[model samples]
Target chain A: MTSQHPTPGDARPGGRTARNTAAVLQATLDELGERGYGAITVDSVAARSGVHKATVYRRWGGVDGLVRAALEHSTERHWEPELTGSLYTDLLRLVETVTSGFTEAPEREVSAAAVAAAFESEEVAEALHRFMSDRHRRAAVIVTEAIARGEAPRGTDAEEVIRSAIAPVYYRLLISREPVTADDLRRAASITAAAAAAGTFTGTPGPPTP
Target chain B: MTSQHPTPGDARPGGRTARNTAAVLQATLDELGERGYGAITVDSVAARSGVHKATVYRRWGGVDGLVRAALEHSTERHWEPELTGSLYTDLLRLVETVTSGFTEAPEREVSAAAVAAAFESEEVAEALHRFMSDRHRRAAVIVTEAIARGEAPRGTDAEEVIRSAIAPVYYRLLISREPVTADDLRRAASITAAAAAAGTFTGTPGPPTP
Candidate 1:
């Protein structure tokens, strides 16, 4: 969706700048969803955003800069799944949110375009890596809480557990081109939970002798 | 590397046709490895293969056709990992071969380009899906062997098990932009083995009561 841009001479400088940035970034995502990375240009983003081309160039420098900024902005606004106390529920919630993007056509198109961009552009790759790292760090809290509650062994690698939990969904999405059904999400959660409980994800040796 | 082309008028018609196909496909991969999917054209493939542009156009129709043919040819020649009887070992071998493509620069470039192309082109996506399906089916034989040997549940979904085992490696390579290390492979094998033993991958309920 295209965002509303502020008038050029808005009385509030901070609000105006924020709205401008938001409009440009939203336009970037829309363009990415429609045209993909290979075909998108700064002029298209500027035309779509209703922002002056000079302003767009002055602010973002180029398409690469705009793409990185747009991704970062999206990740910043992304909602983290609430931790529901149970690790399995928490993981399932997270997985559902991740896979839900694929179930919706617009969101899936944007995600697919972003993924293709990551492979082609180092700027997008680094930005995406940062975005995913932040997401994993947030999701890892479930594992940490589980460890504290003795649901998982101490020294369990939280990020690794989260990664293992979601890997299958992404594999199906990007590699196999399979529709990631809810059943797949449930299975991924179950598999990761079973493995974590079995201490398969602990980075070190078994717990010290009791 | 570009493959040697067949002479214009070889006595054996079948042999000459096969060699021409091989050369064109190799040239496609070489071009993909160097220029990526977004930039590649049929003229480049023809030039690289030492084949006339008209022949390339007539035979392959367009870039999409050439890409599909090249990927299918590559998949046909691809070596399936030898089944090692033990499910864990078989999965590990398969994962290693898949991740090994990322270890070398040329192969990694080609793979990264192919992944990008899959996102951009339906033809490439279908080709990649078919290629991966063949691999998963071959790897599923390990799971079947495991079932017959009483290592896994009788109703274990072999393809799902195989997908679960290798998903983490693909996740790290594509989404996380992280290296799929030997330790990662070992851990994937261990985690999948534990989950399978726990019946997490069995699509149906546990074995029938004795």
Candidate 2:
């Protein structure tokens, strides 16, 4: 049964509400991984989560809402690279994080399901965009640091650099259906680094506008 | 009824079989563009194409087979860039072709559906892989030409260069849910060209090789 207010036990740090939400979100991801977005439903999620159907409905609204929540949760836990002062190392670390999703089974399943869901649902699309934007903004800090150190041009597009560095790996993963190896990751970073150093990403004018 | 033997007119280019096959494939793409892969069915395709359900079933084997045929047909018409002798011009031509799909409504719809289908179905996945590989191989010729002309390094990974040039645009198109612009196309080409000319994609050892 759905309660109008949170239970008294919901007040604590690992409370009933928190535990239930965790179980529900985890169940949502598991269902997505197993069956993809089209096959998932709130009823199935509730059954798998062991939470009451009414609570699942009342709390998450529906399947789309649950998927958005689960994606947000998953991306919150996703890795961000540690800045190593060198653009190449920072980029390599970032590429490692991104390529790991394609290489590892669990991550790959989740990513594949998310990507599928984005094409199927507007809510998932918005959530995915937000998630990627957040990740890109965080990773772009490396490029910003490089700019400060003169490792990259003053006007280099940080987000573009980060996106370009990882785009080839993802292109292989999602589009071309090719295996993304460590070598591929290294090449992606190296190519992006080379371009960035060459001012390829800089939005500066050509020939001083003469 | 399923016919064990081909009709006399089946062998002719403009005959019944050829016409039916063309109609069916066209209907399949229309269905994919309008409703996407999840909503496609053999019966619907048969009805839409004005072909008998039995004929559709017998000829293509099933929905997957029909989808594969449709995908093959679609890719057959997909544009390949003209060789411009200069790598920059050639890559720009190639990027224009790829980005055109995103900018054009009909092609964008079909592409979005195909991308969505690749995530959802194995048949579409195989077809998409083959299609992209064929296109990539064709586009890589430009990079090979560049290598031969001494415009790029000898070991520059031609396929990688092509993929890298277009990856950002595709990444924004599909993943980021962003609108790709002509500026993005030019930037992709320029950055990839810069990297390729710098020998970043050469599969060579850097200073730390020792």
Candidate 3:
């Protein structure tokens, strides 16, 4: 077993090292989707990726590292929310995409596995946090555009708006294990858009309840 | 293996069967908390509960049935959202309770495990669905009371409001893997309450965008 880990210098663009990293991460994701986190091992990932075991361990350290790295690798892929010209439509599209990701095949297994893996590994959990935070930041643009269009106030927390619009969808899909109905999606988008317009998400404390 | 399965006729309140059922399900939850879903087995639960392995299998069928039964058992325990005379405070308390269930010990492990297990078993998924649906129905009393008090419109979707108030917390706790802050709880409650009063949650269609 090599004690030395791969350095940043090994990450040169489009090199053999990059190719190997891509293959290993993709294989790691596939293995996770197929067998889940508990059954995946270094040898399995290495065999699936066609990368040598020693190299896999030398680079990723172990299964936790491999899963975490795979999540981080996914963040590098180009993704942006569809801008549907209005805040409500933009949020509706965003939530629709979120629902599809879990309901659709192939990606469904990988998505659920990633969330499940987080419970078992702090490393994977933190990577998921970073990945989700990145998505949140990217999705905040729709709220920002809405603000410019006079749909919401200047002080609105854009990320919180995104959270409001999509969180219910996540709740139904994963935690509640309920089917995300069309009305569910519409209610989430509409409530969030209206709340934004009402200045509820501006972060100001509400007046004390009488 | 026993060819026959447990029947409801075997259940007698305050009888040996009742005690055994309680012990087995509690042990199942304990095992799930400590070892997670993947590591739990009928034998382990039986050993922990001090019930015989054959009895456990005969009763629960296997690990999946044990988990599903445990979740169903949890629903039987009396649970109601706090009524704080207003929808906002009630939701704040509700979300606080949710955040605590995931961040605190003992229950936290089991809560996280149950959600993770749903990804692995359709039986557990359906059970979780029933459990959360039961929770939603019970918690809707707060909104029902609010409607009576004229805080929200008569037509507001009570369960949907509860979902909106708590979904972001779940998203942060389980999906995004972020720490739930006081601000997050307050914001969720505030947004949902304001939207409830605004009739955004009444299931009415919004005006067509220009």
Candidate 4:
């Protein structure tokens, strides 16, 4: 959603500018995770990043811009679903990855903080939309691979299947505020996998897999 | 999770006291919806409610107390899922209701705000947990009705079934930031209903629904 490189005419790429940008964005995320979006400020980010306050304001604009950039920067980080041999196990892996992102720390605070920040700011919301959409598309590769393996019928809505397998986990952790058991994860994976095999996702059912 | 009546030794429950409580809580919700959690304050709620600031502080304590109370207040609202005979239609109704709570006016702001507030405050989070749990249990009746009618096998986890049916809708709306179409709703209902009939939710298959 945002370029990793500096905005045109803003600053040159690499060296001191690159180091400063990385430090400032990381500090912004740390602030978000620790104190949440409401407490983040340019001065605090600068102090934490060791980048001058004037440099932060000049480059990132303000807290909103900083958060948006941080989200986009994080999106560019290496992430891929572990493609287990079968669709069910592959989806289980996918959902488990999602659970860890929320349940485990470092990522947990920022993941939740981003979602919470979205409600308060349009800039944050748009950035989150892009971030999540990127994840969905990347994870859809599992379903796509399943189709090639003849586990699911052709023309399946791969992203929809991905959403189905992971949504329950999110609903439990974030909305319902319930603990997601192993059984819960298994059920989600099994349901989505079975539905896909039955051609429920393709919208035109072929013969069900025997 | 909180009592609807006055706290012990706080005040009487009838007439002016009740009126004041309702006004202050409603004002709190209004402030939450309009300005969000960060912007809400006792003074603003007092001004909005036309109750005195000292009274607001004395009763609600602070913004956290006000938000927690408002969430608890909203949970007491009368809500029941539309039972449309079949599990699929029933779930469709449930998800549609969930979508509208985020999309429509009056309730939309409060609904999103409450979920957002839960991330920031433990008090609000617990209140949201209770609120959503109540909704989950109430909506599970559709699955219970299905079991009784032999549409699904006995011993199905009715609440888990409800979670599967509605989770995707929420994922699309809040997490992925996608626009939910009628097709998305239908697909969710169908997948969940089929899974239930297949004995996926029961953890032990007796026989598939004929």
Candidate 5:
């Protein structure tokens, strides 16, 4: 969805160019979440970030390019599984990190734009689709590792498992007009853990118990 | 959010009032989804519906009111639970209905408007919230019934249970940009069902040699 490294060929004569790019993209997100797709403009982003208009345009080309960069770059890296010796512990940690984010103020405008983009633009939608599918695959690998360790069943759908773990928090945040409480997080984690555990608890516990 | 009955006392003095209202509203939705909110106009709906502008105004008051009324007086209805004496079956049915809806034509616009309306207008937001909450509660009732039937824990947080049952499809629809296929629906139902069943499936087996 974005360049892992900064875009090539846009370095300024001074060393401040990279810093300027990151800052401008950041303001783009801030404004995006505040104003939505229709309201966002390259000029506003440049003004907000205190970058020159030529810098924004010469480097990013236009609003779509800048928006994609901002949205894709705004995504924080997910935590790696800490392998707390139990699948339940690992996933609970994941759940905790996620629940903490619900209160951090919704990036509603950026979110709104991305969603609108998904409906209105196939290019943006494809990038978003790829990003999400990669995430699903990553979670599946972790859950599959748990299954191998005799923590869950091979039949458990890791995608479904991960989704159930996080669904309530989002529903509350986006639709239900409720807060994502710690209690809710703990409850969801508990249920997911219990189900994952039961998968092995009812079946063979390990590799032949040698 | 929608009304079961058409707006009472708002009908025009026309011979075929019901037919006229449906045609007009359908035309309005078509224009809105295709041409967008700003481009849509009362004149267009009247023209498209083959009715006069006076007729549309007499019923809906104007364009904004007409848009609101269309969403409010929608022909679509929420999912109904099919209690096959199996909580899994009931939940699976619900997920399948919701998942399948995304593939149909109206899902994108419906979802966008519901979400956008929450931010666009307070009145629309209130109606959208009621519509969402009612659908959620319907699922919660099913979870509660499952508990009573010993398919889930006696006092499961029915709302949480409901969210878990439906969350995966939503993520798939909103974020993942994938069609929530039947496989996706089944997997969600299976994971939640397993958890719900585990909470109820204690080893006691009803009564201990009573």
Candidate 6:
């Protein structure tokens, strides 16, 4: 991979080039924490990474490009899939992982800053969307597996359930300025899981009137 | 209330003044139809309502003031009480009311825009949060009522359930660019409802291990 940017040269398949791309992404995250998306420019990143400016621009083009590459490494390295076989257990695990990584503590400082940046800029928003969607795809795989096992119930509406598990933490972070905790993730996980298992996507399913 | 930027001789006792304030709020909603919040200024609102700039300023210091004033009369004229005593029914009604009001044919444009503006602008976001927290108090009343009725299972985390109900719709509106449909609202209501009703909130209520 081109040290400044991943290109055909890096794509030709050698561990050395792949390692360079990894370093660029690593530096990107480092810079993200030191200087958030709003302040971090391509020039600064290259200087920090000891890479040429051409490498940074040629591969990622701009902030969005660099950040997307950053997410490619950060989200994967930081987040791991958990398969507990039970949909509720699995979802709860997923919720805990997400909160622990992206929402709750030190990670939230970096991740939330990025999400807040998305609100301020359209390009950043798109990059954030792409990154989140990719992560969503991973969660989707787990949900689909649960559905196959009948753990998620019939017509569980996996997408809605997945989104439901997430919304509150982010809501609290950006809107309410409340702290998102392990307890919060647990609560979200519990509600979404129980609903998904019971097939709550059907209707209100309130106690029937006599 | 004080008039724009604080003016002399604007103070009054009650009755007619309260009525005038209400009139101003209605006018604000009407003006919002012609322009979204970004397009709205304290000046435009004063111009539309035919109130003095000082009067508008005296009442609301900034955009937050205008938005708070506007929200007073613009939402559901009245909410149905948490009767029927079923939390699911109560919550379904609440979600449907909010989503329907925004999706309503005539008011949809400005209603949606106003909500969007609440998030997009810093001044408006705080106002909107305070606004939602007030509304959330109303929903909380329903959950408290559920606990009183003992219809909610033991150890139920009602607050989490309620928040989850609204989360997806907000996500759909703000991020996904989707209409908050009756169906979507219902699914959200149902998911939160079914799981909550099951007493899953207390602990490890995952899929069946068998």
Top candidate when judged by DockQ against the true structure: 3
Kindly list the per-residue Cα lDDT of model 5 for residues B1-210, writing each as its tens digit.
Answer: 235444544455442577688888888777766666555689999999998898788878886777777676652455566776777778888877776655567755665545544544556556566666777777677787877887777756666666777877777776666776666666567766776665522222111110
Between candidates 2 and 5, name the one with more favorable DockQ: 2
Taking the tens digit of each residue's C-alpha lDDT, what string does model 2 give over B145-206? Answer: 98999878898889888898888888987887777766777777777776677677776523
lDDT of 6 by residue, B84-183 (tens): 5677778787777666656676776666555545544556666556656666655777777877787666666655656667767666654543456666
TM-score of 1: 0.90
All candidates: DockQ: 0.43, 0.45, 0.47, 0.42, 0.28, 0.21
Model 1 clash pairs are: none
Q: C-alpha displacement of B36 in model 3, angstroms?
A: 1.2
Please name the candidate that would achieve the greatest lDDT relative to the true structure.
3
Q: Look at candidate 5 and give me any clashing residue pairs.
A: A33-A109
Worst window of 10 by summed lDDT in candidate 4 chain A: A201-210
On the 0 to 100 scale, the lDDT of residue B15 in model 4 is 48
List the lowest-lDDT window of 10 residues for candidate 3 chain B: B1-10
Residue A90, model 4: lDDT of: 93
TM-score of each: 0.90, 0.90, 0.91, 0.91, 0.73, 0.64
lDDT of 3 by residue, B44-112 (tens): 999999999999999899999999999999999999989989888999999999989988987989999
Instruction: Report the CAPRI category for model 3.
Output: acceptable
Q: Provide the global lDDT of candidate 6 against the true structure.
A: 0.65
Output the TM-score of candidate 2: 0.90
lDDT of 2 by residue, A1-210 (tens): 245455744845477788888999999999998898989999999999999999999988999999999989877885666898788888988988888876677876888889888988899999999888888888889999989988888989899889888888778988988887777777877777777776778774121110
Off by over 4 Å in 4: A1-14, A204-210, B1-14, B204-210
State each model's CA lDDT, in order: 0.81, 0.82, 0.89, 0.87, 0.65, 0.65
Clashing pairs in 3: none
Q: Where is model 2 chain A poorest over a 10-residue stretch in terms of lDDT? A: A201-210
lDDT of 4 by residue, B1-210 (tens): 256555534456664678789999999999999888878889999999999999889988999999988888878988889998888788888888888888899888888888888888998899989988988888989999989999899989999899998899888887877898888888888889889888899874221222
- Residue B113, model 6: lDDT of 54
